[model samples]
Target: MTRTTHDTHPVQGPEDVSGEATTSRWQQVRATGDAGLATAEYAVATVAAVGFAGLLIAILKSDEVRELLLGIIRGALSVG
Candidate 1:
């Protein structure tokens, strides 16, 4: 008796997906080539975060807010 091999459509890899294939987050990121952020992007994000923090600190330190916060803290801590 003789044995024969079958020629099926070909094995697929992680990158080989049908048009309707559902991909995991990792596969999507890999396909997108997410090599770290560029220097300019990092710098801009850092500056924006620092500016936001500074704005919040300024708002919190203003006289009215400072008074309000201190009053709330004192009221909460007081034993009635």
Candidate 2:
């Protein structure tokens, strides 16, 4: 009796016809689900920055803060 051996490679499915495996529709969708994450973060940051600017404007419009800032500038300029 004689024994014989054979070399075999992995089987490629339909999706692997191009020599690379392709992602399924579900996988593609899952991968793209976070595509808008950066946009959403930017929008939130913009809104928060606008709110902060409004607050700063309201504070600077007050007479006390305006006078304090002006006095500081005058003192700094008057130094020799």
Each candidate's lDDT (Cα)?
0.70, 0.67
Cα lDDT tens digits, model 1, 29-80, are: 5665745789999999999999999999999989999999999999999999
TM-scores, in order shown? Answer: 0.52, 0.55
- Poorest lDDT segment (10 consecutive residues) of candidate 2: 1-10
The deviation in Å at residue 25 for candidate 2 is 12
* lDDT tens digits, residue span 46-73, model 2: 9999999999999999999999999999
Candidate 2 lDDT score relative to the true structure: 0.67
CA deviation > 4 Å runs, candidate 2: 1-37
